[model samples]
Target: VFRSEPPDDLSSEKDRVRVIVRVRPMNTREVDKGDRPILTCDTETSILVDGPQHSRRFTFDAVFDTNSAQ
Candidate 1:
């Protein structure tokens, strides 16, 4: 979430904004190991706002599965 205030020269009525959200695809990678195999995955969520003090937010999550957590 984000908030913005209009400039001193601008009035509140003239200030408006829009927001856009996107969930990007996850990335997976493989690793080589002599004892066991390792894998990793990550995903990201982005929030973009355009107009009147543009702002953005990004969040990311990561997980590792070793055949134990399915």
Candidate 2:
């Protein structure tokens, strides 16, 4: 009952899984207690920089900073 043949290349086009993150801004309570930004983001490379933990790099497909509205 098929009108057209299935895709010839059934294999997945991408071999890697992309990551995305949304960084929420600190609440009033956190600010009162001296809470700080632990993660810094790179929009160009979609990387997250964690300040609390040791130096490290996290790759992602997208990143939404606290100031992002869309």
Which predicted model would earn the best TM-score? Answer: 2
Could you tell me which 10 consecutive residues in candidate 2 have the lowest summed lDDT?
A: 1-10
> Per-residue alpha-carbon lDDT of model 2 for 19-54, expressed as tens digits?
557878888999999978777776644544565556
Each model's Cα RMSD: 13.5, 11.2
Any runs in candidate 1 off by more than 4 Å, and if so which? 1-14, 30-70
lDDT of 1 by residue, 1-70 (tens): 4333324564455464333233333335322322322212222223333334654433222222233333
Q: What is the C-alpha local distance difference test score of each model?
A: 0.33, 0.63
The alpha-carbon deviation from the true structure for residue 70 of candidate 1, after best TM-score superposition, in angstroms, is: 30
TM-score of 1: 0.21
Judge candidate 1 at residue 26 and give its lDDT. Answer: 31
